[model samples]
Target: MGTLIFNLNMMKMMKYRLLFLYILGMTVAACNNDLPDELFVKRVVIAENGFQDLRLEYPEDGTVNTQITISISGTSVLSKDVEAQVKVCPDTLDDYNYERFVQDTMLYYTLLPEDCYTLENEGKVTIKKGDEYALLSVQFDLSRLDMFKDYVLPLEVSSVSDYEVGEPKYRKALFHLNILNNFSYVYTPSGAKVYNSGDNDDYTAWTTDLTLSTLNYNTCRMYAGGVYETDTDRDKYVIQVTVNSDSTLSYTAMTPEINLMAEGDASQNRISISESPDLLVQNKSVITTTLKMNYSYTYTSPEGYPYHRRFEGTFTNDRTVFRDKDGNIREEW
Candidate 1:
């Protein structure tokens, strides 16, 4: 009787263990069927390296209106239609917010005015079944904006239908636009051929060098150099040119150097503007200005006597085909 009772207890324990294992396998299979396998709006496609910055130019002579297309791509082909809503909203990471949150801030951008830009996609775009992308078109009126100001447009994904939003970083796109005035071109000189009757018989060949001291849409400050010899003798001059109300030009150069004279002993240097060139002319690349300068400088001769001289000449500087030191074309403003 004792042996029969022990056999019955052993059989009961084995049966309970098999029942527990069978239930666990069924529960795992049910969980696998409930996993998600749907599509989502991944990100906005930008032209360069995922950066959504756009630059538009406003010409001085003609009216310019720009149109740009914004594309949103999905993670996978949609089994059903998915609609995404886009809106012009205040940037979450604006200048004030960025300064409070970011640790190492370098630059800050101002928000663009809503009245200067318009959208034409009805505020919503749709990705149909079997499609993977949607587009939103925006237009900017360049004439309405101030040319000297900088602006930014912030766009956000407000909502979506039948799909989930993507990564937090890709949910919003920022567009940076800069408006520049008419006289923003950098005028670089190639070289100056000095006309003189003193050092090199009648005329001397000299190379001209220029550095931009101050630059803006309304004014340009430049320091010009003319080398008569290797390093023994040279002329240093500074000029500030401003755009007048009539779209003409006026300049102020206190120390205008006339490369002809060798030495002088005067304290004041005077500059007179003769004519202004039209910058909008397409074929006209060179500017010739006849300037009268009453310059004075002192130099010691071998006999220990100071020499003085005064002269005037026509200065012609061709728009130095803009190029970098590496011989590459520079980017336009």
Candidate 2:
């Protein structure tokens, strides 16, 4: 009986010791909660493509309030203060040329330590426990960007836990911007038409109709004999046609008041009739008339269709003083 009682007592003592050790381990873990493994960013929200703001939480879901807070404990793994910093750069260096073409510029964040917290360009930060954690705030401006295409901004963070002072480490973050296209349409030609509405797509030599010849992939040339407008709307037509050189001609076209960045650009060459007396003759005699002409034009728009311009003038034998249909000297004579 005595031996049995002694054995039972030993077994109870062992169980008690085991339970005590487990409770002690739990207490130590709770006190060392601010260890390196426990310390981390809880939320990383991107305000814009080029800006990433960090949110650190303690004890889970603890709001740092307009500040980035890191917890550190003196007893456990992260027993030392942390050091942190951030760095940033453009995502596509090769696309820099395109950015310049569009007048897009780059900007970087100038970080300042908020509430007396220290923040360095290297992105080093420090924090401690029982003291409202240190906060880091970052400010950036990107309003200068006119347009963006497949661009990225990268950020990195380096920090060291309390106990590990010498071994500094880092984490990375990123922001993005995708600016769309910016362009405008000033003027464009629809197609050409003449007295003969046949499919005049091919013409070795053309007259009267003033067919435009294809100059290049994007250009065409024409000398219209009859009356026509440079625009299909016919709101504006060639006022006076002066034979330029053998293959080219200089003519003035009337159009709606133009609003453009640069005046007198090719766009200003609308087709219109000048009320000047030299171009507006009356009672003209019909003689065997021949109009020798050549022209080449270009398409500023995507479509290669030649914009039409109306050419109106009476056939005349006397080249010195041309007569309008009214048999009077042309206006501006």
Candidate 3:
């Protein structure tokens, strides 16, 4: 969205830079008036749209409200209101997918289902007199959507009451669903012991946090066995953990160099949530996740000595999400 026209004149001095910018602005103003007098025109456009990501906080009540704005482009403001017709355009989504991923079919976005969302404004927008844009409202039922699916709602300004329907490529857009990423970040790790099981020498507190990296959408990878991870052999101590739909945990060893296996009460390896009665009712609430696991791995040191270690503990991540006075959630935490 930002571009710098690196001209020698503009770079000469600060004063020259300001003057160059003024001249450029004047040039752009003159270009707008270059349209032939015989063929005057007004255009309705949605910025070049392949996929516009809209963030959703995973609202607790299952209901979500959002809006999109459409704008008109012209040299002069309209004296009267202008109406525009909008509709779901599947072909536009197709063009985007084909252009973006010709053969990588797996990454293409799926069309949002009808039951998941409701177009509250029906498909019409009226840009009022002296206004350049109008808003179209939408509501969504989060329970009906799959968190793993890449969903997009394709829309286009199909017709305008007076102005031209913009450029063919710029007229349409896709609203992509973007959900907050979960369960991957720094979490406090405690009650976990790290030591050379063979020598019984404790290496506890070698690392302070159970920092996790994304292994997949549903799983995270962390340093296992030797919690005191070094840059060179970090991959050798890698372990992946996944919280399943049934609240059970799944574990994996990324490399064979680390002898990975479960330990202690395997059945207790699960995710537990701390829920509040006033959850979404209070306009703001806290979310805390505690991951409990019992696992062990053996790492062979550079000197050909093997250090068998056990990682038995829980990692906790806690944060508060606040909602505003206008009922909008500020959930970036």
lDDT of 2 at 254: 33
Clashes of each: 1, 61, 0
The C-alpha RMSD in Å for every predicted model, in order, reads: 15.9, 26.0, 14.1
lDDT of candidate 3 over 2-103, digit per residue (tens) = 235555445668787789999999999899779554344678876545568987645446677888787888777677898988788988888888889998
Which residue window of length 10 is worst by lDDT in model 1?
Answer: 263-272
Worst 10 residues of 3 by lDDT: 1-10
Model 2 gets an lDDT of: 0.34
Instruction: Judging by TM-score, tell me the better candidate of 2 and 3.
Output: 3
* TM-score of model 1 vs. true structure: 0.42
TM-score of each: 0.42, 0.26, 0.52
User: Mind giving the per-residue lDDT tens digits that candidate 2 earns over 1-333?
Assistant: 999999999999999999999999999998777456545432222122223433211111111223333333332343434454444433332243345444444343222213312224345555543342355553322222221123344544433433332222213334333211100001122232222222345322213334332222222233233334355633322222333223223443333221111113232332321222333434433222232222222212226444432212222122234566666655211
Q: Candidate 1 regions off by >4 Å?
A: 1-51, 59-75, 93-97, 100-107, 179-187, 191-333
The reply for model 2, stretches above 4 Å from the true place, is 1-80, 89-122, 130-135, 149-151, 159-170, 177-301, 306-333
